[model samples]
Target: MTQAPPELPLHMRRDHFDPVAELAEVRESEGVRRVTSTFGMPAWLVARHDDVRDVLADATRFSNASQLAFSLPDDPRSAEEKRKALAGQMLATDPPDHTRLRRFLTPEFTVRRMRRLEPRIVEIVDQHLDAMEAAGSPADLVPSFALPIPSLVICELLGVPYADRDEFQHRTARQLDLSIPMPERIALQREGRAYMEKLVAGAKADPGEDMLGMLVREHGADGLSTAEAQDGAAEITDDELAGLASLLLVAGHETTSNMLGLGTLALLRHPDQLALVRDDPDAIVPAVEELMRWLSIVHTGVARTTTQDVEIAGQHIPKGELVLCALPSANRDPSFIDDPDTLDVRRGSMGHIAFGHGVHHCLGAPLARMEMRIAFPALLKRFPDLASALPFDEIPFRAYHFIYGLHSLPVTW
Candidate 1:
């Protein structure tokens, strides 16, 4: 039989609720260590909180755009297709390029905007909760509750047909799974782009009130009246529109869905914390923050390529190298917090790099927080005695994937 690939490198390893013990050991002993990526590319893993933050903060030294230059050997896409793939991707660009795209999107994602969508989000959460109750106990929370809320929210926000969610969700999940062959993942990515391109065409024909419509109205080829052009509204190509929409569609749902699924599991495992969130209105906010800090679900953050020779924690790394920040490890570093391993929902508003840091911090942070803030407390209040249907060990974890989360969480109340 053909041998299985080696286990995920230490930076990506997690033991359910915590980073692996060895990861902690490495963080404390050596702030930066070399490791092979899931794709078998060699990289420097930055583990300490400070060093990771510095790597994330200094985009000039660590270039996101440079990292995009490194492509999978198995990828068969033409140079043009690959260029289209990176178009308008905020995470894959640096400085002015990222700033330009982000400026158009920032207005759409502000805290004020999230407030306007709050009622609809609450409606979506309740709709799912009602469905879960009607379906009775032992519901797989992953599909029944955790998955649909954010998926529906993103679908509505992006003006994608909710009817097509199953197809897009399947595409994104398969594409993000590191275990899937790289070529197959690239194909799924292409399918997603094709799907979004069709939607972009529709938005161009007639803009709706959704985000895609907003983009088309403000940045589409025919966009920007002379006055608006002066205000920085520039005409964007169809590929950029499709690329931006595709990025939002994948990210807006995937990260939050996993947070819901994995966070619910974390809460169920700690009943005391669960009760705090369920019983007290104030507790839910802090609880969400703590859970996010504890769960740092994005596995290793986006890889950065070094622009020049750099020294981190007294270790010298030469120019043009890949640097990976261990988000979970950095979040759990003892120096970053007291009793770093323990879960305490009462810790209010600590700075955690779970959503990443600096210029590339997650743009959907407000929307995600709003969803979780609404969904978590609502689920707990709806099912006060919520629980795991199986032993912890029996629950499946998405261990080898780029994002860390539960594959399915069987629950009962």
Candidate 2:
């Protein structure tokens, strides 16, 4: 018999545009509070902005490598299998190992590289807008607009064939949905790994100019030498390559797509902000930042394990305890910004921890920002009269998933 699904932790819970009141209360009254994690493990929820940043910044005191210990109660994978599963997953590893992997991929995500891709991104956004307009109004923006733009962008970037997007997207969506049974989610994860491994093998055979091929050409076994190996040059293994690609593919699209869907709904709710984002080109950059801050989409940064006894916000946490940074709480902490609950596009949300902080900051942040900067204004420009088809309270929010977003956003112009 299978075990029951775990409850969604308080830190992950949200109420429409804001985090639940309880999370705010905790951030106000106690900067650090012990809570039961989704996996039923007792974890410390770091609620203040400063505390969360400090936790994320100090990799020595807080180790991400031990986070894997909080896996499903009935997971049957062997120790080696589990280790391989996390091989190149930067989010699952600490420094030195993570440092090596990130070095290989950092050049591809720089500002100059994103600038080079800007024209193509613009074309892709326009193409989707054309399709949405051609299909007429009353379309669900989730699939028609929000999902496909970033999905195609990441596919081309990673060298994954866009035709296979449906399968992988379904797998990833299910993989992150906490409502799904643990066993089924694990099965989906395995399936996604197998699918990516084949693509990794193809990239190894005849490398293309995309990121996977770049890794295969420069960091694969064929490219490194014994002398270089001694000098600390690392060759990315097949499992590692697959793991990294899978992570990029999922993150590259999911977070941005959700932002598009949810952000559109947010703008629709506040017409004045909507008008600002749509009419003023200068307003979009800061507007995107504000949206990301308000959304705080990912429930919490990856759960961290305490390497030594640590005191945060005057609360003592013993070594080997699981600690989570409540990102929504941190972003919404009144001390972090003025009028934390209100959505004001004019307020530049510069220091928000939306894409996370410290070493584990989202590698694809530049790409995500570029996509939003280009896509949001272009989308508003294309559909000047865009309005949500559903009522405010009727919107279907994907609350149980690791990422907060809309399941579907029906709209008309």
Candidate 3:
């Protein structure tokens, strides 16, 4: 078969985008196209929701445990120097190991527990607004607002000292983030490893009621020894502890920050939905979910690898190959969503892959939902007429790419 095109949709690179036209082209292209990533050891890209679902639901056929899923090396030497330090954590592991690790974290993220956190979330939202008002109008919503709010909240839960939150957020942003420059990301990962070791030691010696403390008690939350390594280890390794913290911090802040910027921009364009939320506080949570689907903040799919040769949608995928899940495609799949391109607050977002699905679904999803439910309403209520200060074309975006995010959203009331 002839090689397919390598060009990804141009709009995919932007922070704020409506890829309806682009996605339609992708849908047609994927049906016949043999897409490939420029990244080493190329694999076919699956852009249709059904193809993605087939890949996701059949983990045995399409294994995520393959190092190629994330494009990392599996060498024991690199692993000892780099790989073993963080490999086999929940996000990186498959099946039984993934299952076991996720078990320890399930309860902390339940919607019920998340509901109880709404009050605390409200205070956090309000505090950011309060600070914004005092600082003056037309504040950039990132550092002053969007980013710091969730950073602090997760730190509080993890028992990371307020003093260390800045560093933790910096390091967490690096390792989980694929958008940054490679050298910087590698350096940040190293910094994260050193920081987490100290934090884990602190939690080990003096456990608190926080999640890390609880991890110490339940998962042993202590340093790993040779005996523990033989058993796949636990309460935490330098990598596991750092990885968990990294996952939570990124999930907690990045999505919310994107939603705050992107969702706010979308809401402004959709007057009816914005009016509905402005009229009723109870509408915030579900509204947040809808916005998540609409924004699809993650923008791309989860990555998986083929464990065996399999025919999906009549297309053969060979063993030991990589697959990008195309999550944004799933959220807008015509089979599942009617008028998928249209933003509708009334639509059900429960099935949206905005937080992904199955075993590797987002653990901090509930907390993220709660944060937005509280944050959006309080933002509109306080400012009442917050408006972007810069032209839509000129608003700032991160120098780094991959993540669809605005670097600075200057808005004035």
Please give, for residues 263-282, the per-residue lDDT of candidate 2 as tens digits. Answer: 99999999999999999989
Give candidate 1 regions above 4 Å deviation. 1-6, 222-233
Q: Which predicted model would earn the best lDDT?
A: 2
Q: How many residue pairs clash in each candidate?
A: 0, 0, 7
| Candidate 1 structure, TM-score to reference | 0.96
Which parts of model 3 are misplaced by more than 4 Å?
Answer: 1-15, 20-22, 38-41, 68-77, 174-179, 221-239, 398-400
Give the worst 10-residue stretch by lDDT in candidate 2.
223-232
lDDT of 2 at 297: 92
TM-score of 2: 0.96
| Model 1 whole-model lDDT (C-alpha atoms) | 0.87
Q: List the residue pairs that clash in candidate 3.
A: 79-83, 79-84, 216-221, 219-235, 221-235, 301-326, 301-327
* Deviation (Å) of 168 in candidate 2: 0.5
lDDT of each: 0.87, 0.89, 0.67
Task: Please give the distance, in angstroms, between residue 393's alpha carbon in candidate 2 and its true position after superposition.
Answer: 1.0
Better model by TM-score, 1 or 3? 1
Better of 2 and 3 by TM-score: 2
